[model samples]
Target: MKMKKVQEILEAHIWAGEEDLEGEVYAACGCDLMSDVLAFAKEKVLLLTGLVNPQVIRTAEMLDIRAIVFVRGKEPSKEMIEMANHKGMIILSTQEPLYMACGKLYAAGLMCESED
Candidate 1:
């Protein structure tokens, strides 16, 4: 799915990297464990995480994740947003829980690495 459509589907607020929202996201991975993200996430995927910190941004950069959806209204720190912006990673926040957000996006045709 396109990042814009994912934002709409999740009723997300774009917190950073707004200019890059038009890009495509072939898959998604929802997890709070940074190790799991680093181990499994593929390129151009959207990361849905609740762990709000600079390390989340760092993980996304390492995986070449195209976007991040902060679940259950979790917000990123200033440094995290700045890092995401610099890496061209679109950041979004939603009130939905991580599982719900992931399900909604999956139904909308976004899958995880395993599903693909």
Candidate 2:
């Protein structure tokens, strides 16, 4: 799915990398555990998490994830945003909780890596 569509599906607000809104993501993963992300996320995946920390950005970077959706109204820190911007990754935040956000994206045809 296009990042813009994902944003719309989740009612998300872009926090950084607005230029990446047109990018494509083949899969989505909702996880608070970075280890789970490392183990399962594929290239260009959309990461949905409620954890607000710099480590999230680092994990996404290592996995080549281009977009991240912060659920439950969680916001990334200034340093995290800067790190994401430096890495050219798009960051989005939504008021919905993690499960609901993931479901909405899935219903919109954005499947998980395993489903893909």
Candidate 3:
């Protein structure tokens, strides 16, 4: 899915990277544990989490994640946003719960790395 499609599917609001919304996302990973993000996510995948911390952005940076989705209406801190901006990562916030958001995207053909 492309970033624009992801935003539409999750009903997410883009907090950054308006110009990069056309970027493509082949897979997704959902986790709140930053350590897990470091340990597992693959390249060019979108991260879905409820955690709103700078570490989340750092995790994305380390793994070269293209975008992040904050589920359950959560939003990141200003520092986190700045961190992601510096890394050129797209940030999105959605009112949908984590499971529902993941399900909706998965049903729309965005698979997890394990499924790939």
Q: Which candidate leads the pack in lDDT?
A: 2
**lDDT assessment of candidate 2:** 0.92
Point out where model 3 deviates above 4 Å: none
What does candidate 1 score on TM? 0.96
For model 2, residues 1-116, the per-residue Cα lDDT tens digits are 99999988888999998998999999889999999999988887899999999999999999889899999999999999999999999999999999999899888888887784
Clashes of each: 0, 0, 0
Which residue pairs overlap in candidate 1's backbone? none
Query: Of the candidates shown, which would achieve the greatest TM-score relative to the real structure?
Result: 2
TM-score of each: 0.96, 0.97, 0.96
Candidate 3 per-residue lDDT, tens place, 30-91, comes to 88888887888898899999999888887788788979999999988888877778889999
lDDT of 3 at 42: 94
Error of model 3, residue 104, in angstroms: 0.2
* Per-residue lDDT value at 98 in model 2: 94
lDDT of each: 0.88, 0.92, 0.89
Clashing pairs in 2: none
